[model samples]
Target: MSILLYFTIVPLGTAFLVTLLRKKKGISDLLAVLSSLYLFGLSLATAGLTKSHGVMIYKVGGWFPTIGITLVVDGLSAFLLVAINLVAFLVLIYAISYMERYTDKWKFHALFMFMLAGLNGVIISGDLFNLYVFLEIASISAYALVAFGVKPQNLEAAFKYTIMGAVASIFILLGIALLYSYTSTLNMADVAYCLSDKAKNPLLVFIWVLFLAGFGLKAALVPFHAWLPDAHSSAPSPVSAMLSGVVIKTIGIYALMRIFFNVLGVSINLLSVLMASGILSMVVGAFLAIAQNDIKRMLAYSSISQVGYIIFALGVGTPLAILGGLFHLFNHAVFKSLLFLDAGAIEYSTGERNMDKLGGLNNKLPVTGYTSLMAAMSISGIPPLAGFWSKLIIIVAAVEAGYIGYAIVAVLISIVTLVYYLKFQSFVFFGKLDAVYNKIQEVPLAMKTALVILAVICVMGGLMLTGTFRPFLEGASNVILSGTGYKQAVLGAIR
Candidate 1:
């Protein structure tokens, strides 16, 4: 069970070690990439182990739940671990070459590892206070990373992100405090066990509202999404990939799901609220994306829209719907990360992010062009790609749940998604090559390697719903479906 600690410790330690080795040439890169690779492999192994071993629990210093910090690696934890570490590893690889334009590349490596550590901790931590702590760690690192360029826009974006992130943290802390005062414990499983026995009241209702607002802000759901586009577009491309692909999912959606479904328990009212928010985010985000000329900004807005599918599916509260949500979560991480990296490569080669200023890159940057095309298609829900299947499942599940109106809106949004992505491909890759960019070369091998692997995943990702890969997603969905029974699983695992 101590293996859970490695996910946190290695990255945190590597972060510190990278800081010390900042002056050494290449050492920081080596350590950061190696640590990320190890964590990715370990996460994959943990996924396998959890599927075979059931839930595993680790108590710090031999203390029991409610008495000490506990770490758990259930199906959900392992599933997220794999997604987070895999994306981190790939982003680290992409950053190796992409970050050369900046000074103090080692600092980026350090902060990235810190964020990775925090993300892993958020998934594995068994208590609410620790979850908040880990969330802050990740949030703070992200704020700084967004400003890594120190450009005026980057500074402004980071400041806005810091302010919004602080507000969200405060909301989450206040909710945790109220929950603790009522239940007399912070261990999530114990809190759930306690809450299950108590009658619902006004204070609990207030707690739910607070937590939803807090996590909703972090997740950048509609009305709460002001910070995401700027923060994501201003950050380095690899950082953008991490932010849109895994960070929001981890500290935002993942936290929301863990608390609402497993610890606090879900209700019809809560589910309806989620559904409404999801639809709003979907429509608003897609329309905004269609209006963007900046490539990274468009992708950032697109992320908010794609995330809506996941949120809406989860809100549907059906078994098939939960499975669809989780599947789309995983698929979004892959294709979105790939799309951002492709954007970075284009910028790296031509120093242009405005789609209108770009054209005919297909022949010159074949790798970037084709990969971007694949990712754009996947995100647009084109058939036979990973994104299509997840979106299909979500739409099908929505109809099955008798939310025919929601399903219709989802289908409409998917069409809008395809529209903007076609705009992306047309303006950037399919037209006449700009004379200024004619001499620009493809990105370095490292960036292309990251893009190609992710593209391959986008192509093959549909297979996840079949064969051995299905269990990884199913296991995670089963955890959410289990609801308050999560407490019994954790406590029983401890025994």
Candidate 2:
């Protein structure tokens, strides 16, 4: 219970205190930083405990079994905890320096902390309705954070995101209601258990459609991805890192995998649909991105493309394919966040995100230039970098699963990916220096620290595919692999 309460307490506590004294402007940054550090520590402690033992269950208000809202710390939760908290800690470090340009640093930190709480809560929660609650928490904070800049574009993007997100939430809620009505249980595993032997209902297909629509919007997959570029590119950099990095994975793709694989039990038809969409997103996103001059906008389009690879891998549904998909998910989270943060750093220094307006920064903004280069290479699947190994596995798995066409497409996109990245590097950092950026300096220490740490992770994240690190990706994959046994795993672990 302490573990679950930590989520509620830390963010609520921080939010309350921040709101009360935010007007003071004194000691707010210190308090904000301290609160985030503490939350990071808590998540780490939770991770160590889960890795050492097995799942940890906390039932709220003394309710037992399927009757209560339960927070479960199984392999899936633990893996997300590490990824979310790890990125968050680095984002916080970056925010310390990155947020200096924005006013009301305290309020910014407060919103950031609340966002983390919502994300963590969404990951750990075992109850379907509770997941909705946490999803809203994260989404609402995100809506505000996207508009944190209060610029016309920021507000417009935030408005668009809010409307789309609200629609998605309604779809999810309606699906939950249908599930609750059919199974008479709000608990996920319990619903799965009750459904384990139940005859197929036509309602399931309907529910699947609803879920696909909802989470697809959340994940920003191709057709549903229209909102992502505008929103992600408009938000502040640290917020951009968080949104592109963890929020979409936790609230969107992660939930989709959990429900489709574990709870709903997807069919071959479902997988075919998944693979087709993945391929479409991969090709379309990459093609569109190559023409963009807005660096952040380009990255946003690239995100859609990369995320397609994960979905395609998952659609293959092979062990190695799932491994590749999950590996790519984590690897993408690390380097993508670094890229966004680096973008933020450059924007902070020069107040420009237009690639054509900037150049020759390799010398002046060494930290931003090199770190972003590493992230670009990692994302483009350069050898020995994190992106290459996961991508290799995904392509291999696609071939293994007899999707040679998909494999060919994935490979081609890798080349396309490299092309756009080179274009970004050439236009943003390698060409002649822009006269408007002459006096820019390196970002503050805290932001630099964030970039360096994430760059190191980008260099080494491929190690996650290896022996000791295998458990993180593998254990999380097994949770989905054992989708058939999912009901048993959760029901058996009940108090």
| Per-residue lDDT of candidate 1, residues 34-97 (tens digit) | 9999999999999999988999888988887789989999999998999999899999999989
Q: Candidate 2: deviation at residue 234, Å? A: 0.6
RMSD of each: 0.6, 1.4
Please report how far candidate 2 places residue 142 from its true position, in Å.
Answer: 0.6
What lDDT would each prediction earn against the true structure? 0.95, 0.88
Quote the positional error of residue 406 for candidate 2 in Å.
0.2
Q: Which sections of candidate 1 miss by over 4 Å?
A: none
Each model's total of backbone clashes: 0, 0
Instruction: Flag regions of model 2 displaced more than 4 Å.
Output: 23-26
Q: Estimate each model's TM-score.
A: 0.99, 0.97
* CA displacement after TM-score superposition, residue 12 of candidate 1 (Å): 0.7
lDDT of 2 at 172: 99
